[model samples]
Target: MPNKTLRVERVTKRYGALTAVNQLTLTIRAGEVFALLGPNGAGKTTTLEMIEGLRQPDEGRVWWGDVDLAQKPAYARQRFGVQLQNSEFFELLTVRETLELFHSLYRQRLAVPDLIVRLDLAEKQHARVGSLSGGQRQRLALACALVNDPEIVFLDEPSAGLDPQARQNLWAVIRQLQAEGRTVVLTTHYMEEAAALADRVAIVDHGTILDEGTVDELIHRHTPSAVLELSREVGRDVASALSSVQRVDIQADALLLVTDQLEKTLIELVNWANDHQRPLTGLKTRQATLEDVFLTLTGRSLRE
Candidate 1:
């Protein structure tokens, strides 16, 4: 078992009559990548802020290892680094100069050049913040977070808007952080991103957790069906004929059929196609994924 580095016990936060974060309890292990997943108003950001000491919980308590965050906020803040979803930086400052400014605030700082390389900012060390692209700015924010050489790090929506290649690069940097045995907690709506990087994930909705576990565990627990997709050409009639399937939907050029009896469904579909002289092209079968689990629990997709 991994060491529990951060613990939140029945913590709740509210803004007037609206409860942004309901009574929530969770633990983040040392050297693990834990993802907080939900929609825009799902209290993910509020929960993260509470743990990071930026906001106080109306009830319950938060502990950073053995230190009580409410009692000693400064100590808790020192133990962890944070990269907010949108942070303000001096537009006129060069990348190197920005690091120097942040380093001054921490008693123990990581090497500036080393952090830049780790975050893939080596070529942009002297580039002004105002001139960097969206991806470059994100990388710079990540670099700034590491200056403290913290035991744990919090990244809120680290990859919100970026090209595919840029997102891939940012993922590589996160993997590097994991390899160095730093506990990382991040919030994201991208299911694939959570699937790729998280050791465990917490699914939240309406200010509460619907499920929490490894990706496979959550999917298995919430989504029991297998997905069989076929080309649009033969999907309509075949879907109507699928007695074993619980649900079927059209997505672009493919048909998504959800069923527990995969073998029986496939055999029937194949036999029907063969008898009708209609070959089913683009036939693919996959197990239920995190997205399926999200839909099952929340009655909506994560993106919705």
Candidate 2:
């Protein structure tokens, strides 16, 4: 496969009064893992669908290198692998049998048993799809997607229902895909998943991109400040007096002092508390993270 960037240019999709995606544009560099991250109803799923050629954008275009996806839907179907948000398979087929069924549809594919083993379904190769656990089912869906030996893989919430260990396992598989020089695009709301897997990330909401960059870039750009939390609420005046503090936020469970100089702020707060004969209860400090960046941009929790 040629090393060409996958581009989504000014893509927009709408359903009645709701605009699911708004002039969204981004690029996926060849052989890199790209993540589209946002909360539910954030247009993440719609964006993936449009690029996978499963759903048409009401406006704009998608291009894999010089080939326009809109103009060549078969080109996408032959080269792009997609694992849908909801992948339904025949219930009674064994795992291997299902993989074989999908393999037969494509001109190029991994051997059914090899694909099953690659997905870690070796032990359950004969297990009926209906009897497989949620994680197994997810792996089967992934296996089906790979049966086409696609150049670009689109995964929508690939690890949504997976447990911690299973999620890590899947992350390893994604990393392997990257190492093998395949472009991967996955949409996820899990901050850690995106941070751990993506070479670059685009944070999207309300059908448009809010920010796009490496995880560290987004965090440092939007939330360069560290957070110092106190168990009890403190007035803005008190927090503002702290050294190098940028702002103060009153969270439901604590008072947060946002500061560029974390060590200086904590020292100042401790000295003030000592002088005033008051305890700085439950003092905790942490560097800003992707979650903070998301909240800073969207003004809401990512889980929302």
Candidate 3:
């Protein structure tokens, strides 16, 4: 880990009466991947903008090492590269030409040819920006962000519109950036993306940090080691009495039993169903995941 830490101190942002980001504070170790995981309109983008120097915080500071970024925004612009959620480029510019244009903006830049090859856009070098597919355009966006060879990269939903394979490819590319010792910060609504890529995750909701930690730590904190689903609803009283079950999440069409001992709990449920002469229908078992963590914390689904 790098000795210097990137810090966001007591940041707050508001628009008239609506506060987008509350007094949020967190720190990132150099060369690690950190993610602000939340649903849309949960202040993830607003928080990122303040840290990126695209927007100033209403009352807070962003610090890099010992330097206060709020007082020296230009330094951040120079050392940090950003790939916005919506990146627009000249329709007629070729992939190579676009990289060249971005490279011209920075004093120190990488070789455009090497960047194109690195981003897997070697064959698409001659293709027009207007004609590229969604995945290709996203790769090009990442390529533009790297023209200056920044120390830190901020990606805003890097794989938003990509297909499954493209998303997987993008995830691999992000891992490569970490391997190169570049710090990566991203804002995402996808739990899988955060779980798949982030070293530490901050669960955000209503413009606040509900919880923050490693995926396992967060899940373990909630004590739901496994989730069991049933086709029928077991009344709250009956479900809560199940063996080794930590909690019961009752849904309209199904009942979810959150238990610590998966095998023992399933056996107890089966015996109970058999005693009542009621079949255990539509049963499903899954290990506790970040989605469960989010729901347990907020009383709502991550996608909702």
Candidate 4:
């Protein structure tokens, strides 16, 4: 019933020499959706598990309001809900039955009928868990997490395997939860998902936090310049001739140039091309995005 603030301070988890989380510290404010984003093996799930009281950390602490998770795990867990990367359901149980079972377990039961409808399960309420589609089952798992009307919810890849429409439906439900003043912590590999839903984001890599901020702020911080793509091959001569360009790199078959003066760069390129009688073809320019920033920082893709 009290106000909630989820905090993880200097948390570390390890297995032999392979550290899973390395002295990570993060805070999720009340009623905000904070996203933990990283590639596979980046220790995202490990960090979330420790905070959920499912995995104890080797060092540091997790707190739910004033309750210390390592010291009082039961008390901490009761205040939040978790939809893990893999959630299990009784295969034979109908959707309504599953909701009823979870409802009975919680000290405070949310209205199953309303929840079922809100989660878009009204028609499938009678369907057995095993018979539902992947998206349907995903929605069911999310509904179970909310059956307790938890003050905080942790969702690990809630929209991973769902279709675009189904993912959008889930996003709508998440927004509604935030609108109701419930704090949500989510882990996702999808950049667009984080950009669209998260109030703040933490980019994790190598078992540590690399960057954290609003989507726009992060993009602006790391990739402060625009990129111009040219169709022509970047030969040794052409590459050396681009002294007017501050930074020049090749991505795929395109050349990425980061510069403070786009106009000057374009003018120089045009003059050089005219002097050499070489045509500048297929030129395009775009502002940097979160994907560009992440790739620049991590030197890898989100799914890699």
Candidate 5:
């Protein structure tokens, strides 16, 4: 199969007065795993739907290679595999049977047994769809999407309800897809998942694209500094007076101090606490992360 480049050009989708996706433009390279990272209602799903040709954009173009998806959805569908956020199957049907049913719908398809084995579902191949666990069900969803042997795969929150081990297993499957030279576009609210699996990520919020880059690039661009976290609350005025502190953010139970000069800030913070007679509980220092970048751009946690 040929790897396909997918592009979303200035896409906008509105629901009455509320814009679900606003002038979002993104280019997903072939054979790479691109993740859309955002909180709930952040237009991640809407953007994916528009690109998948499930919903038409109010104003924009979605192109899969030379084909405009909005104008020729059937052609796009034939080339792209989609796994919706909430995938439901015939409960009575066995895993192999479900794969067979979907395989029949596609002109080009992968062998059912190979697909099952790739997804580590050999033992559960004969199990009823409804009888599988949450992770098993998720694997089955992915298996169905791959049954068509698509060039591009779109997965929306594929590991949403899975446990840690299951999530890792799902990530492995995603990596295998990338290894097989398939273009993968996924939407996720899990920061660690994005950090671990995505080659590049687009951070979206309130229907707009905040930033797009690799995990390290985003952290460097948005949070090019170390963070000093303290459990004790620090007043904004006091925090602002600290030397070398660029910004101070107050969380529920901690004070996050962002600084470019880590040494200077640490010394100043220590002296300030000593002078003020306030104990710095749970003091810790760490490098910036994708989660930090997300909070920096959106002013909210991914789970929020």
Candidate 6:
């Protein structure tokens, strides 16, 4: 396959009074693992569908290199592999049979036996799809997507509803896909999955692109501070008086102090606690993370 860049240029989608996706623009590099991350109705899937040729955008254009994807959807389809959130197969069919059925849909495809082995499905080759575990079913979905062997692979919430071990196993497969130089576009609510697999990430919320960059870049750009968690709530005035503290937020049961100077903040906090004869119970310091960046941008957790 020729090296190609996928571009979503000022795209917008609407359903009645609701705008599912706003005027969003993004560029995905070839052979890079890119993740669209947000809450359930953040338009991540809508944007993915537009780029995958599964859905049409109300406005704007999607381009694969210089070719317009909206104008040449059939050609785009030939080069894109899509695995939706729920991929249904004939439950009675064996894993190998399921793969064979999907493989027949395209002229260009991978060998079934080899694909099964690559996806770690060799052990369940003869097992009926109905009898497979959640993880096995997910692997089968991935295998079917790969049967086409397209240049770009689109996965929507690939690890949802999976156990810890199963999620880890699926993550390894995604990493392998990146290693093989396939451009991968995945939408997920799992923060760790995005942090672990994506070369770059776009944080989407309320039908708009909130931010986009490497994990570290996003965290640094949005929240370049350490978080100090206090056992009890601290008044705004008290927290603001601390050295290097940028802000203070009160959670349900704890106080979150954002500071750039961790050492000075700790020393001040300890001194304040000692002077007040109050225990600094459950105090901890941690560097800002992707979750922090998301919360800073949206004021809500990704699972919300």
Q: Candidate 4 lDDT, tens digit per residue, 259-292?
A: 6677778887888888888877768878876777
Higher lDDT: candidate 3 or 4?
A: 3
Q: Top model by TM-score, which number?
A: 5
Candidate 1's TM-score reads 0.88
Candidate 4, residue 189: lDDT: 87
Higher-scoring candidate on TM-score, 1 or 4:
4
Distance from true position, residue 136, model 2, in Å?
Answer: 0.6
Q: In candidate 2, where is summed lDDT lowest over 10 consecutive residues?
A: 247-256
TM match of model 6 to true structure = 0.93
Which 10-residue span in candidate 6 carries the lowest summed lDDT? 231-240
- TM-score on alpha carbons, each prediction: 0.88, 0.93, 0.93, 0.91, 0.96, 0.93
Model 6 clashing residue pairs (backbone):
none
Name the regions of candidate 1 deviating beyond 4 angstroms.
Answer: 1-4, 230-242, 247-255, 267-284
Which lDDT tens digits does candidate 5 get at residues 1-304?
5756888999999999999999999999989999999989999999998988888899999888888887788887777889999999999999999999999998988999999988999999999999998889999999999998899999999989999898888888889888888989999999899999999999999999999999999999999679888874666777788869888776666777888899998889789888889977778999988888987997766665
lDDT of 5: 0.89
lDDT of 2: 0.88
Per-residue alpha-carbon lDDT of candidate 1 for residues 1-304, written as tens digits (9 for 90 to 100): 2355788899999999999999999988889999999989999999999998899899989987787889998886666789998876999999999998998898878999888877888899999999998888998998888899888889999999978998898888788788888889999999999999999999999888888999999988876669888898885766867798777766567787778999988998988888889988999999988887887788676775
Please write out the lDDT profile of model 2 over residues 166-248, one tens digit for every residue.
99999999998888788999999999999999999999999999989999999889986688888764556887777588867
Task: Give one clash count per candidate, in the order shown.
Answer: 0, 0, 0, 0, 0, 0
